[model samples]
Target chain A: MSIRQIIDWAIEDSRSQMTGTIVSPFYEYSDYGGHWVWACDVDLGENLGVLRCVPVAANNRELIYAEQGRAVTLSRLNNGKWVITGLAKSLNSTVHYIFMSFTDDTYQVLRKQLRGYIIRPLTYGELGTLVVPYGYGVLPYGAQGKFDAEGNFLEIVETY
Target chain B: MRNISAALENIILGGGTRRPDYKVYAWDPAEATISEVVSANGILDDPAPVDLTPYVSDVSWSDRQLTFALVDPAGLFHPDFGELRHCLKDGAILRLLEGDETVPEVDWAITFTGQVHGQIGWKQSRSTGQITSRLTVFGRGETQAYKRRKITSQEYTVGTDIGIALYDICKTFLGLTGKEMRIPFTLGRQFKHKTNQLAQVTPWDGVCSLLKVVCYQPFFDGEGKLSYVNKSLHRPAARLFEDGDRIKELEVPECSQDTVNKVTVTFLDSQLERVDGPYQKLGQAQVTTGFFSMHETLETWWSEDRKQRADGTSMKVIKSVNSGILPVGSEHYTQLDEFHGQIEVEISVWVPILATVMIAEYLAAAFIPDDVIVLGFGASEGITIPVGRIIQAQAMIGILLIMMSIGSAQYEVWGTPYDFAYLEKKSVAVEDGLDYWLENNLDIKNDFIGTHDQADIIAMTELSWQKCLSMPRKVSVADDPRLEVGDIIGLPDGRKLVISALSKNIKRGEIPTLLIEGCKVLTA
Candidate 1:
């Protein structure tokens, strides 16, 4: 079960600014094999924060990392009008993945969480602390799946 | 559409009657066995006139009993057949040879549930010294054991699902093997019975009759399980006699003027009556719409009423039926065991109606309203009703199950009344009734001419599925191994046919002769 927290966020553009709550835990751990793996947002370059897994023996869980003290402001949106409409958290083992939904269904901030370098356990080597560090290489904004030379997402181009 | 018609035609009509090449296959399910009888009969010395006569018993549903006699030497029996007399106990299949030792693809059949019921003794012929022992067997598929059972004390709501109910009933009561029973027939609108009480009836007959009443086709497959399916829903396998098709003689019987043009089913409520054991009445309800009338009744008992009482402590009885699944799992029982000083109780101390017990009570009736089932919780030792619910005592519904009887439904089929069609009414106690339907085609019409058969539903005012079984047509084409009982085939004249019965001559290595009997259905 993944635990996601929601908070209001502000996207400030010089001329046009819109405010919406941050869809917490935008990253999810749907199919972790219990093998310790890192979830890093660095590769995404959007600095959205990492998604971490907490293996509390009695209640093992997952959560998206929100860098401590980071302002409640969002990453660049390239002028895409999206509003975080609702926030939810799931701790039910029956749920395969956790999510942070936005008003726009087509809004695609999802990415490769387990794609980088690996770790052996859920954070603490003792398995008691049950915390893991996120590790992955940072990519150029365009190289990551966010945009193309024309500022249009290749994913959207191929999907349509 | 696997078209094996051309292949069947070559063998059916192109044969040189000199002892057509074929083999006979018989399946004995009681032993879970199959056999090829290439030479079950020694010789057909006087095969002049084949004695293959197919008799559909009026007393039986689509009596596919293939009756024929073959002479053999005295006391000769196949080792595979133990004691010879018990050879036909549960179900046995008979199909003509399609060639080779392998089971044939095309032929006639029946899982003989009735005994060889005919004589198989010595016979004397006139003028010749060839006195032989003749064996006469009436292979039948009539297993009406569900008729001997009944359901009691339980009430099923009007909206209860008919398919799930029947499936559960057959699984719980019919005692059929996992593979022996199936419910694959698709129905458009499910039936919801008002509380209709039945007393000692046949659920098998009820379900089958209900299928006919609703115009759904139900029958046993080659294997022995009882399953049903809507014939019209089936895609036409092959055109029987298309123009320019390599076909044998096709005969279309003239419509008869003696056909009836109306049918009525009436089912009365049986909730207001006496229960054989110590039980308290719970509740009852009734609803009637011209098509059907439903009534529901329920009852329970007091657990403290029969305490073996060593200390006989006084307590209260619990009223009200909303215990919410009873004291609840282990938590409720633990609470129940903690005795409260004194609380006078009324009605069953525990429950107003045990859902599990009530479901078991009406499982057969609720699911398959036409099946006859009688359920009694348990009349054995190690099985005792749980006692001391909450503050007082009363009979736990699960501890004691009253027998419920569900009456059989009789399906009536007919043409548009103006068609003047002399349709053959297929009388069948479902060997297998399946549930499936296309939402777009649910409105199959039941234009009646006659609906009542030997069905035992008293107030059965109207048939549920307004469709009628009105066609009584028969076609004799070369037998195709791919055909089955409920298959709906298109004829040359654009008339669709649902195969009702099939017969074949085992001695002549004959092709299968299909019986297209039953009420005609108007697909359009």
Candidate 2:
């Protein structure tokens, strides 16, 4: 089979062997509410895999509106970006996982497992308080960062 | 409160019915004022706060900048938008105001002021599609251009009033002829023979060194005038901070390293000397540099001896590095009373006199003498060592030994210190009598010598000021043209801070950032 076909079959099969919780500010490691159970399939290359997870409403409230792709970036959401360990899924469907380095896409992700949502780069000076995952790093740190009217932290996701 | 510069007021007010939304003024080199060119009041925008450095301590060597992005839709079609390159020149000053008033109030003051240094340029509005310019200007501190211009007189002696000499040097030597020169009027300093021999050092360095001596702070005013005030002697800028201005404070710990308790100003003596050579070949000529410590060498030879400059200042010329070349054929006749009186040899060292002494001492210590004790590597080497001529072979043997050692090293020897002094009315540098720096800790030497021991006190005070009160805080001011960079702002708690940098984005209706340094000591 061709490389692209192999990738497509593996993803369509929905055979997820590995599972972990999405790093989120509002959810604990085990809580199912806002935590996303992701299955990442490593590619032939080292640490190169696709991440797949399902979108769920946090506390079963606000609408889940997003289009998760390879690189999502927004000037306002400059606080937290999960090194989403996959492509994003809509509220109706399950999110598929494809892993690469943490690359910035447009700002359009609002994933929930059971309790809270996972976010992008934290604000400047807010890093010391964050409990970071092993491979995750924060970007966009400065007092002059822009924000939307709602005061949601803006973020840029990238590997250091 | 202090009033704004007239030139600045004229452009900001005269532009149109409204004062310039935000101006980026450059200090004029010809006139002690901001240029009318770069000074434009575009529809000012809220300057983003991220670009400003919160506070700057090393502004001395860095640019004091005012940077912002603005829209200029009319381009050259508008009468208000003149050629901004002149205004954005190296020395341009920036003054920012808040309101769009036709006739502004003193209270509606300039919120920002700095000199122009650079630009990143024209963007157009998406809606109106009008083009705008992003201009950046620096402060007056950038006037120090390291271009080498010769100071005609080798030495300038500062009499009772050093101000006149400072004014002359700034006006003439640095080519700041048209610029206003505001110097301290009080007369007490006796700074003698400031160094001009240093390659690439501008006359502005001389000005700083001079101010360093008198315990003065050198700065250019908003008017672009070069002025320095001995605050204790003259009144400082007005206390402008009042209530109502919002402020943020960040307390910085004391930094002792920036402060100095003492200073020493070192310079060469103006006296000149000509070295005679055995052969009139240019290769046989010796060179002397300002770094040679004459006083150290002199004191080693002449114990308890003191030599003074013509202006009565202590001797500092270690040795004058000579670069003069002697033409051939003229050597025989230039050789006065050839074969008899005395003979000369030349060395290729920076200090010819010291080379002569070192050669004599090296030979006497190595080959001949038993009871001869040489001090300080023979500081008194040329001083009557083999006992002055004392027949022929004694002096000739020393000369021959020097000539023999030619392959090992180079030496350019003249008659003696006495011979050179006789030919040219110069004092023999026996020892540097000013040993005040030596008496103190090796590291704690004063670069500026005060009238009394005031240099130490002044250095310490300046250090304390730099250390304790330099905590800088950055904030975004929305609008109101009355405030400028130098304007002081008093916090609600009554603490004062001096604005070091004020950046405004003319197209965005708000001030993006203000770098306000801690001015704990409120000045008049």
Candidate 3:
């Protein structure tokens, strides 16, 4: 596709990702209190896709106010790699994690497990990075690493 | 019981006997016939009758009282004459007869009458050689007394009568009169060795003592022999000697050389000088030349030297510092005496920059974020932002920050640089130093262009562009003739476009406002 077309698709996809269906684990504490999980597919029209889930109150029909977690979507570009973007809200803190992305790899999963968040301008092919959304006081620390083929384990290289 | 005259006569006669056979008799008035008969015989009759009646009847002949009642010529008898008669011996001159009557005239009897003048006759006889027995008596003693010669001149010295007066005058003038004047005539010796003894004496005693030693010479008129001179002669002479001549000649050897004590007194043409030396005023005896010397030294030390003035008084210059006077040479800390034009410009541009940097350092530690870097831009075009733009940025941040912090709300800005550049151009610096900085560092055309893009971009958009376009611009009409009604404006290209608005919409209040406008670029 042309660059304009690509930009138009990215814009449309960003909008859909912002407003599409969400999914999360269904939970019920009583007859009057229960949450319904919904999901939407973010597709870059090739092999790259992201499944997003949000918890909606069954009684109120509103999205669940999740704390310390986020909903995200991953898309693949023409280069056959994936970029991720999402909205995150951290409860009881001033930090708000904004849209960010990285490639489709176990490195992203390792970053999600270790750092609990992600950010844009993903660098160092196997080492996933994140934006901390820190204010004047908050600092983020992590070690540089690589993901094995199984993508279940990470190999530490350096720390910063 | 003894008569004084008789006693006196006896004492006088005790030394020598020179009798002229004188007798004192009384005249008998009853014996006048006998006195007549005696006078016929060539005898000198009684000069006056003596009264014998009272004496013959009253006296006893056994006392040989040939009482002759005599009367003095003043008609009073001597009071001692009766006592003299009582002291006469018994059987002495036992006769009772009148003055002219002698014993009864008998054969070969001598007659004793008044005033018998005896003529001594010479007889030449055959048995004896020639005898010259005539008495040659010159004259009888006269009844009047003798007069004495007078004195004319005399001499006196120190404490004699005259000298005492001189000493008194000296003491009165010199406060030394009552004392013996214990002054030294020689260096080591007193003129009068007996001054202590003399000081004890009264004026008279001192005078007498002085007189006993002094040679008194008297000038006298030679008349009678010295033996016959009476007391009157010597007494008056001594008085004159005391009063005049002696005092005039009196000399005090101790005071002879005392010139200060010398007082000359004149009587007509005669002048007398006090014979004292080294005298001063009475109260001033203790004063000396050394005292005056000390006074002069103190005056010299206490008195400051005065500079002579034209009016004859003196004054001194008082040095004072006048900061208003321009300092000469290198000591001046100001450029008041140097080239005046551009120094103010240079100083004004740099001073605030340094001051702001200092203030920024202080603020950065406190309220400002540590990451908020303070760019120390120099004066070069590439390095330093124009001062007008900087000031505008600061004002914008201050306003926006106040609104955000106090109102608890966000604010939006239309992206444009025109407003800020307009504000920078129109805002007048009210102070000298700031005005100088604005004039030198801020080029109006360049500042207008540079801040114009930023102001236009900020004014065109409705987004929260306050942070991206930090500089503030106040809306104002463009004074430049080159700028027109429509313009396309942008900030430096590297920065993002925070917002945009059409200049026409801004003027009509459709968009917020276009604070500044950039250069017009038209495309057909």
Candidate 4:
């Protein structure tokens, strides 16, 4: 049986007290089943998170922003890892978007190291680093971020 | 008051974090095995907890009844329409446990233990869509079976120990084991042996007769064991409650108008030797017939006791009949005609003395021709014999008397005397105190009472209780499983009362409450 649901439950339980927008992992991955997983990271501002999908067969990635502000949480099935769902909105589109670095064996290994953003491999074998998705232009305390020239997000400074 | 632990007390007082819960188990006494009927934690294999709501337990000095509803959505408890229907067997014991989840089950207090009393049934709520199975259980010792079952015909001799006799009855008639009873060694009463002791009563009445002889009463203790205790003994008060002590309500009812102000006990004196009536005229009847036959009946004032008689002789029919005709002095040639016919008769009567019947029959015949008539009496066609002269032929005839046996009581063969040979000596005891006098008198008739001293003791003891029964007091308080009947408790007014009845209702998420009723205890 997959422990991915258990991890998802842990994350949901841990995030119950969190009020700000959550910049969850946006990297699209195919689960044990053929279903595609979506990116759930959203902005806490008036704008919403962008829905992005990258099919294994399609060469180009698609992106579409949410129609209205939405909240996100992770859910899972017995077939695979986790699915990011928007509360009451549909934003199915294609575009390059931000994502978290943690997943599977790689995330398990990086969790034990220095507590900071770490680089990890994407589904298409492209390299990406985890982004805090906060303090973007025209948004305060929202989880929206812009990437650098090499498609790398700037490391967020920890105030704690 | 009822020996509850400190932890349980804390929970009841709202000082403990563990919530109070209840569990009920169905126990088979025959197999000595127990199965969970319902509990707060549910069954071992099944995780769904059984609903125990609308629970009511009413316990009194003479009875203990428990009623509760188990919400059965799956129909597990339905008797007629369910996949896993449970048919509770007769005499199946239901044990109630009151405890919290934090405490081990073994440490839970068994508030009640009773047998299923044949009231189990299921009902569906139309509004709530809930199917509930209701069960009613009666305490084992207080089951109506004892009051309904009659003890077999038996006899107890003089000096027979009442305690031993009660033990035998509970074991043999009631089918109770030694562990379920607490019989005293001797009840301080013995058979007087004057009037033969006979057991022709129900088991409950039998026990009552034996115990009342010693001034005791039968009750099932809190643990569901039979106990015979004397209420006259002064026991220490269990607890004292003041005006503000967890007491929700209190009331004292006025004395009833029918309260007994005087008690008169009348019984037979068994000490005096037996005495017979003056010659005791048994019965008499007359018969007159012309055809040498006659029939008549004699009504008796008292029954004829053949086995035991006041004169120490077997019952003998002694009677005299007047033929009402002068005997003609004549030789063989001129004798009245000898009538040739047989007499047949039957007589039925009731006798209150011996509680038995005595019947005697006589048959006589004579040979004479009906052609010749030479006697100076009635006409030849209507000759009367036994009461008038019989002119059947040329000969005269005289009737002869024959005797038969008498009938006695039904249990005469069992050797238990159904009737006392001596006349009963009435003994009366009166108690009419001016302070609480209402002129309501009580007349008690007890066959077991043999002496005037015993009669006085019984009357005075009964009067003492009748005086206090008028002042009934009721109180409502937070539920305490420890409270029991016969407990002497102090009231807010400082008067001591003996609990006679109590009722309690248990529900989840609700604090149970108790309603108690008692009678004031009169000080000596």
Candidate 5:
């Protein structure tokens, strides 16, 4: 086999091995209609390997949108919009993971897990129009990057 | 230059029915960030909070003077004047934006931004029965913060790229982000900075000196970002100022006072000198003590000498390693004259014996022996005396006599070599027997000329600039809000003038006139 085929096989094997739950939490709905899930149809378009997900709020829902060849975390706010929190490696096949919680503590645990990575909070405007991220503060941090990827706090080097 | 919309340019060229007007805004320094203040436009929601356009009067802005007045008649302004007073405190931001009367507020472009300086003074006119409060402010550009940051001591070794050093200084000391700076690509001139010489200089001056090496000047554009510019580059004409244009007055004066037929640049040069080593083995001995088998290795290298520069002053040698290379040991380090010397030595090991290896490297510098000198090293045996004593003992016994004098070993003497200062001058004569020579002996204290080629380039640039400065024109025109510093205006005589400095005053119910100083005029 060619080197590219060998690399693809190794990547597929690694992706298969990493298909497990990173974190799980219990959630309950008052309506007894089962916990709400912020699931959306995967949009790969002409590009089949990449997943294009819109930012949404997930106030009271579980996020389960997934695509092939890519792995990412989607957090839902109480307002039912889902947002991308972090990116992941190892996703050779289509996989979906639902993360549901009753409080912000579960997301805090995930934030602690992916410390230094830049986490963007995707939000929506009135009329259900998706508000594209603009300026800087759209992330949880507004130009002030606090935690690094390894969960280590960085020292602020400049003061005005 | 700030790019204006075509409609705005038409308004400036006096082609529109609506005339240009300016609005002033004020923000407290502690209450708002510069990014917010810079991007603020009072369209719907005011970002700067306070509008000072109603009370602002006698507004004038120039390179040297930026002053305005706020008039109050029997306190008719009431709470608005009080609010304006609160916003006009010291260090408060004063922003001026220009737009026509009928245009949308978003079309207004910022004309000037400054910070309040000193105390706001008040004066009363009994005849007019009105009290005037005058406020003076200083233009705070991008380099203003860097001008306050002082670097006590810093050094860049010879062959250091000027561009990278400047970027490092801006990033480390000024805390400027990558987007805030636009340094040109690395010109191939190497820069060397002496720590003692640049012991106390602000980052602004440091940046200016580095830019001066490439004949460039540092300036802040309208967006308040630091940029390097070379005026020698020809720029296309921005606008033509001819008849029917709103020009008040124009004068082109020819003077030979600034004409240069010669330019002299004095720079320090490193002159190399070679000195052989003071390496010698006084004596070797084999002794067997209470051990079954023993082997020992002993080697020594030492030098003692002093050299002076061509200026007849004692040379000061400094140990400096290249940015990435590491020094081997205390005895194996590179040293050069503190002021003007380049590092030309390669790192290598010198072995003396086959069985045992010795790393002998000499970057030795001049030594001033005002007192006693002693040199010592360990031998094969455990107990030992000083090498001087061993020499004395050998001389007293007369059996193992070996004279260890100066220049005994065949090794290279490594120390700071004497360097001298030389003047590299370039000249261009415009006419024979009519020499209008303007010479400038640049003080090495102010100029950073490290290499000979760099000095030549700087001298040529100075010569060209001086030649261009021979013809300066002062032009007075109606205030055009679209006009900016560094804009080129075409003259009537098929010549182009680059606007170097400008002064203007904006008043109500009257035309604002501009005074422009064009330092260089080129053929159209």
Candidate 6:
């Protein structure tokens, strides 16, 4: 019913192909209403790599790779490799499984739709583990996915 | 000495005196000849010390005199002589001796004579002149000096005109000098007297003019002339101020007792009427209304009839009245226009008259403490009919009924209407007959025909009708016996009277009628 619910449903549906599970839900900071970012660890059974994803809105997704103390950009040549850049915490020595998820709405519409969903009844401690993860990757390979609960690929919606 | 003489000459040429306060003499030796052979008889030709002293007596200088002898006949060797001869040549000089070996006690005299020689054969051009002068010399002693002494002398002459000019220059110079000294001085005193006099005079003239305009005097017979009376007499010490400072103190003359008495009479007649009489009447009226229902009734009536018709007739009757008299289906028709034309002039005049009476009654009701009411209706068919009033006749009957109810209640409570007279007296009362009619007819009543008493119904109806009436009533007691019977005889229903014996005992006087209608009705 709400944008957050839609994002959660998309993330949950994408978990089958995802190599990692969500370790933390989206943490919010005020930037145009509010911005949400999350990090997760993916297994990537064949080789260990990292994936970082920033979801600005339902459709806007940026895939990154987990690196030493940062999330670095992943080139098309290194597709499916996760390189972390501008991470608040260090990911240098230990290998992490990164996951990314996105929905298909604009930030404004998404915010308006998720107003009630964002202010859920969950306490601070419970919300830490309740978040869902979709795409996953390793350090050399970045993962990407079309996040949608009803199988509709995320699409950019433009407003004047 | 020669330089000194030259300097003296220069000084004299420079317009100053070259001589001191003493005398000077010039000498020449050329005029004298040595007579050495004259003493040939004197012993040996060697000119034995022939004691020339005897000749010295004639040549010696005395005290206060000086003599010089010239030895050379030329150059600087010139001698001083007492006289110079004209025959002497310019280069001639003789030895000259001067002596002052004389007694100091005697004043000495010196004489010098100089004769001018004319140029050869120029006697026609030359004037004969001789210089002879005497000098009285006084000193401690005299001397013959061969030594040269330098002397300098100077002389100056001052004319009166030049001295005056110098004095003027000095005066001007002194004046400038005094200015340069920068001494403080008083220039002149301020001339305030003229300004002050003008100031006082103008204001004085203004004050006099103001007094002439504002003051009055009352003349008396056989008395001395009286000054103008000051109207500010009560406040004599009043002062006027300019810019918050007192500028003038007003003096008010004392008013005579007679004048004060007259003023008191005038004040009592005019000003005191407003303060005392009206206020007392208002106070008394307020008290009566506070305990009575007079104003409530008056207000209700005025508000209801403010824009309505005067005679309280319905629209149908009013139109009928305007149409005059007409019979049904009569060919001899009375058209409304004709009927109105016939009555228009009379109605116009009569309406104003009735309106004047009504206005007078309203003014009396508003300001006077006497009950006065305007009955807006007149009886039409002698059935005590009130047809043409704006308010229903029954409504006026209601005011009377209310008043009678109050009166009877007061009588029952206090034993007499007079006992509550203070509570009943009012200046104005307006009754809206409509409100009573509506209330009595439309309002629900709980009790209905429970008591079958005819007298009670009559009494209640009488009281109710009195309460609804709007006519004025005066309270008084009957005073005459014969008039009582006459009053009963004038009643329209007198033949139907039941209590004749009791009616005979009633006193007669002109008390206010209690009927709500315009006409007065008698009752026995």
Cα lDDT tens digits, model 2, B28-52, are 3344443231232331122211112
Q: Candidate 1: which stretches are off by over 4 Å? A: A1-160, B1-63, B77-115, B118-121, B124-127, B131-140, B144-160, B172-174, B185-199, B209-214, B229-240, B254-260, B263-471, B506-521
Clashes of each: 86, 113, 46, 16, 17, 80
State the DockQ of every prediction: 0.01, 0.01, 0.00, 0.00, 0.00, 0.00
Give the alpha carbon lDDT tens digit for every residue of B138-218 in model 6. 121111110122222121122112222222222232211221111112111111111111122222232222222122211
lDDT against true structure, model 6: 0.20
Score residue B468 of candidate 5 by CA lDDT.
54
Highest TM-score against the true fold, candidate: 5
| Full ranking by TM-score | 5, 4, 2, 1, 3, 6
What tens-digit string does per-residue lDDT give for candidate 4 at B1-524? 35566677667655445455677666444544222322222222332222232232222212377777666777665667554333345556666667776666666666666777654787888898977666777776667877886667356666777777777777777766566666686777776654344355788787777777666778775556566545552567776776667788888877535555555554545554432222222222233322122233222212232222222111222222222232211111111111111112322222111112111111211333334434566555553344211432212122211111221111001111112232232332233223323335565656666665665566556665665566788888776666777677887777787787777776544556678888777765
Q: Kindly list the per-residue Cα lDDT of model 3 for residues B1-524, writing each as its tens digit.
A: 00123333332234433221112233332343322423232222543433323322122111101122232223122233333322122211111221112112111111122221222122334565432222111111110111122212222332233344334533432223222232112212112211122333333333222222221111111000000111011111110111111111111122211011111110111111111111111110011111012111001010122111111111111211111121111111111211110010011233234445544644443443323333657533434344444544565554443223221111111110100001111111111222221221110111111122222222211011111122222222211111111222222221112111112111111111122322111110
Better of 2 and 6 by TM-score: 2
- Candidate achieving higher TM-score, 5 or 6: 5
Tell me, by lDDT, which candidate is best.
4
The true-versus-predicted C-alpha distance at residue B398 of model 1, in Å, is 69
**Interface Cα RMSD per model, in Å?**
30.9, 40.6, 46.0, 51.6, 35.8, 51.4
Clashes of 4: 16
Off by over 4 Å in 3: A1-27, A31-160, B1-468, B475-524
- Residue B235 lDDT (model 2): 29
**Judged by DockQ cut-offs, is candidate 3 incorrect, acceptable, medium or high?**
incorrect
What TM-score is obtained by chain A of candidate 3? 0.18
